[model samples]
Target: MKIAVAGKGGTGKTLVAGGLAYLLARAGYTTLAIDADSAPNLGFLLGLSSRDEGAIVPVSKNEALIAAKTGTAYPGVYSLNFTVDDVVLKYAVPTPAGVHLLVMGTVASMGAGCTCPANSVIRALLRHLIVDRDEAVVLDMEAGVEHLGRGTAEGVDMMLVISDANRQSLAIAGRIARLAQDAGIPHIALIGNRIVDAGQEQVLRGFAKDRELVVTGMIPFDPAVVRAGIDGNSIATLEGSAALCAIGGILSRIDQEIKERLNGRVDTEKHS
Candidate 1:
């Protein structure tokens, strides 16, 4: 299953992504967790030490690799069809929590109408991961869906728009849903984070209903999560965490959705 988690800044989307990836890995799936955010904190949430996090060179900033794959031609020339199949094995950092992480930093702009080498490599690598890889892939994306083009979006099985019970957050979630739909993402659902009460849940459900989106899950506001963040500890290490429990349910729903899709396909084949 290929999933993308996105939300407005400070909505705990990274936490959702990390938790889902951890759960999937623990369930015996080989998971690749990609940090596609500009300010990458999935490493921290995934329990990577500060030193290990610092050691990770984001693909977008790796000049030599980018040049090697995209060529050194300036002004008007570069290879758009470069191979990035080995990038995961070559660059992914395996965490003790059992997920392989690949950080794709933000691409630098080279004026207008020029596709930078870093972007080219990142796009190719993402395509390979989403379309070719058999493992469960989770992308912790930026606030917007800018990194996901139509081709890449189509390959994703689901996009979970995480949001809090706030107007601005819900508004952004609506925008993200529309953008993901425009990019051909088939399933888009809302995951409510930091929901404190029934009122908060109602707010999220109402917003999702208004936007014609599904509310797949709701994660309550857990003090353990805040404490972990403050202590620079991994939330996954908190055994029996309420937030984690909620996320596990969400993952189960996602798994069931995948199975339903496969069963639907099989039924269609049998009928045909």
Candidate 2:
């Protein structure tokens, strides 16, 4: 299963993304967590040491790798097609949370029609991970709606748009949901994060209802999550935390959705 977690910054999307990866890995799935954010901290959330995380290089910023993959004999041109399957084995770093991490720094856009070599490499690598790989892939996408274009998230099983009760976050979540839907993402889930009470939940649900969207899940504000951020500890280490418990419910929802989809497909086939 491939899942992409996106939201306005500071909505705890990384925590959800990292938590899902850790849980999936612990559940015996070969999980790969991609930090596609410009300012990445998924490695820290997955319990990668500061030194180790610091030593790692993001794929888009790797000059040698990009040059090798996309470089051509021409001075002003680069190759547009290359196999990126080997990149995972070569660059994915193993974290203590049992998930492999790959940092894909922000892809630069020179113009509306421009396609830089680095951008090509990232697009191909993302497609490989989402459409080609068998492992459970969790992507922590960058803030706003830049990361997802027409086909950027096409093969992803689900796009979890995280939001708080606040209007700014919810607005961004709505925009993201629309973009994901336009991108042909099969499942787009709006998750309310950092919810404190019934009022907050109501606001989130009311907003979704007004917008004709569904609230797939609600994550309460857990103090343990706050402490983890303050203490610089990984959410994987917080056993029995309320936030993690809620995330567990989200996992169940995802599994159920997938199962139902498969069953529906089989039913359709039988009828046909």
Candidate 3:
């Protein structure tokens, strides 16, 4: 299964993405977590120390690697037909959470149709990971779906648009859900995070219902999650955390949804 976690900034989408990746890995799926956020803090949630996370370079910023993959003999010209299947094997960082991470950084030219070399490499690599690879992929995307071009977005089985009780966050999540739908993602669902009570849950559900988006799961306000972030501890090691438990439910829902969708497609093809 391939899922992309996206929401407005500070809505805790990265935490959800990382937590899903860890759980999928624990469940015996070879999982790969892609940090496509511009700020890129998913490393912290995946058990990387501050030093290690800081030392790692994002794929878009990796000048040498980008050149090797797309550079040409002529100045200002680059090739687009090079293979990117080896990028994961060569650059994916193995984390303590047992999930490999590929920090793609921000695809600045994404969706703008710019054929720049770096964008080419990044886009191709993302498509390769999502479409070619068999492992479960949890992508922590930027605030919007612009990073996901049509081809890259189609490979994702689901897009989890996370939101909090805040109105602004919910609004952004609605927009993201619509964008993911337009991008041809099979399943687009909303995940409510930091929910404080039934009222907050109701609010999230109401918002999603109004927008015709499904609410896959709701994560209650968990102080332990806040403390873990403050203390620089990985959620993977934080047992008995309510937020993690909630994310586990979300993961199960995502898995089931993808399976059902795939089965439905197979049935349709058989009938056709």
Query: Which candidate leads the pack in lDDT?
Result: 1
Give me the runs in candidate 1 sitting further than 4 Å from their true place. 72-76, 108-114
Off-target runs (Cα >4 Å) in candidate 2 are 109-111
Q: Which tens-of-lDDT digit does each residue in 1-272 have in candidate 3?
A: 89999999998998899889999999999999999988998888889999999989999999999999888899988888899988889899999999999999877657678888888888788888888899999999987887677888888888999999998998788888877887778778899999998999999999988888888999988899888888988967666689889899888887787788789999999999
TM-scores of all predicted structures: 0.95, 0.96, 0.97
Which pairs of residues collide in candidate 3? none
**Among all candidates shown, the one with the greatest TM-score:** 3
Question: Cα lDDT of all candidates, in order?
Answer: 0.89, 0.87, 0.88
Return the number of clashes found in candidate 3: 0
lDDT of 1 by residue, 50-88 (tens): 999999999999888887898845755788877898899
Worst 10 residues of 1 by lDDT: 107-116
Residue-level lDDT for 141 in candidate 3: 91
Superposed Cα RMSD, model 3: 1.2
C-alpha positional error of residue 56 in candidate 1 after TM-score superposition, expressed in Å: 1.1
- Which residue pairs in candidate 2 have backbone atoms (N, alpha carbon, C) closer than 3 angstroms, thus clashing? none
Span of ten consecutive residues with least summed lDDT in model 2: 143-152
**RMSD for each model, in Å, please?**
2.0, 1.5, 1.2
